[model samples]
Target chain A: MRAGLDIDMPPSNDPFYAGLGQAVRIGTELLAALIVGGGLGWAADTYLFASGPWGMVVGLIVGVTAGIRNVMRAAQNWSK
Target chain B: MEESPLHPFELHNYIPINLFGLDISINKAVIMMWVVVGLAAFLLVKAGRSRRMVPTKLQSLGELLVEFIRDIILDTMGKGGLKFFPFIATLFVFILFSNLLGLIPGTYTVTSQIIVTAVFALTVYAISIVMGFILHGVKFLGILVPPGTPGWLLPLMIPIELVSQLARPISLAVRLFANMTAGHTILGVLFGLAIGGGLLIGWLPFAFTIAMNGLEVGIAFIQAYIFTVLTCVYIGDAFHLHGADDHAH
Candidate 1:
């Protein structure tokens, strides 16, 4: 057990854990982007436009696009 | 009488206080935070007192922690990110101690509270935004619009970038809160089983409870490291948004 607790052991360097972290980061980023965009759109619809779901519909589309873009960017960054 | 797995998380006011229409009671969670702060301060002060020619054990331990935090910041943000060392170090140590301390029986876990982690996350998020504006002025908005983006695509790209940026704190807070809550809840359930079962069957769950405790200790450390590293990454993004374009291949 003492040998297993070697200070020199590079624990975080494991690719598996790194990949898992990246996956979680990417998943959450995508979800958050959609929520924020749609949320802003909903707020605008409610307060400014009174245009029913039009604002939210646009917001969701914009959000999805943004989410995809974020995922792509994250993937690129991670690969580097 | 059966106890709920979440009974440990219930807030019981040690000294109930109401002032200015606010329930500012001293609860277990609040007391635990104070205890963690005191312990960290005491340990750090003692470690700093011994400036020996050859490092003492306490000093070495302190230096090791400092070096670990420094390495995380440097790795994620590079040399320019060193300026955030103090803030990041404090955040790391506080959360680490809080998580570890919660593992002891009859102690509350501060990080398990969504509000606590959310506040920490939001504060980091605000600092990153403020620092970006201070360092880059109007140019900081460039973070919302990646370089080499087509002129027509700006409408779509901007919102995506904005949402992605906003997600950082939410993820940061939720990750810590969920991890701590889940771990503790599992441990609680297992212990309840061990006690509820007769002596013949109880030992099985008791053994599992011990094993789970060990895993929780590792998770406590990991969550702290993750929280600090993400903060560094966010700060790094703000300071070096332009550099990101250069590195994008």
Candidate 2:
């Protein structure tokens, strides 16, 4: 009875095998994101502790770099 | 008459109700859940009532929601996933509306409560398990055992995969709850400070509130998207789209 309401059905024999390779790729993408995000966060917290104009400059650079890294990772992995 | 800025969750405003001799305090979270359900039903009915080539604003709004959800489900989970549209659509609408509703002054955020969010997470977890088992029969657990893993490593890998699989619901629920609660509390504290402090401090807090509120709106859309996408991902696992073969990746 509940089957009646299902509108989305998986394609028959639609290469379920293909996903294994994709999973490996996704795992790499995830690791890359974590490593990049963590590395940036740490760098910002460490060397950017100065409160003067120079500190602001370094912090901004680190933030932008980290943010870009995250975006790149996401953009790369968003497709099937 | 002045209204209380404090939401129902504040302990000072708490009320208790007795049902059949069982004392259950009717918390703000419960009230908000009721409101979410009511608003969802109202929007759906209003949106469903009129069928037209040229739709009115309200009907068009509903149609837009339907189309939006349909596309998301179709795109991410494949056409086969459409069968679960009602479930997914309901989940999205309920979560999206509930999160937005909490933004209104004087309303409690049910999603902010861990219990409430956990229930949703558990529901997703249960469905994933049930669907996996039904689709794969005894092979449902086969999902945790990735194909091509060395036999000796199977013990370690399976446990890790199983743990990660279990973590899905907790992560799903906590992410939404934490984001919503943190944002709401920050907004609350800021606005409260705005009221308590003079214009100088108030101005900064007020600006922050507005910016955060805008961010929250973006978050409302994103959480819905994330929840739906993850749903597709889990369901995809059930179908073994990623290859559940014993020697698979």
In lDDT terms, which candidate is top?
1
Query: Model 1: runs farther than 4 Å from truth?
Result: A1-27, A45-80, B244-249
Off by over 4 Å in 2: A1-76, B1-15, B18-24, B241-249
| Candidate 2 residue-wise lDDT, B104-191, digit = tens | 8777677777777788878877887898889878877777666688999886665445444555566567667767777787787778
Worst lDDT 10-window in candidate 2 chain B:
B240-249
- CA error at residue B3 for candidate 2, angstroms: 18
DockQ of structure 2? 0.03
Model 1, range B166-193, lDDT digits (tens) per residue? 7678778887898899999999899989
Q: C-alpha displacement of B237 in model 1, angstroms? A: 1.7
- For candidate 2, what is the DockQ-based docking class? incorrect
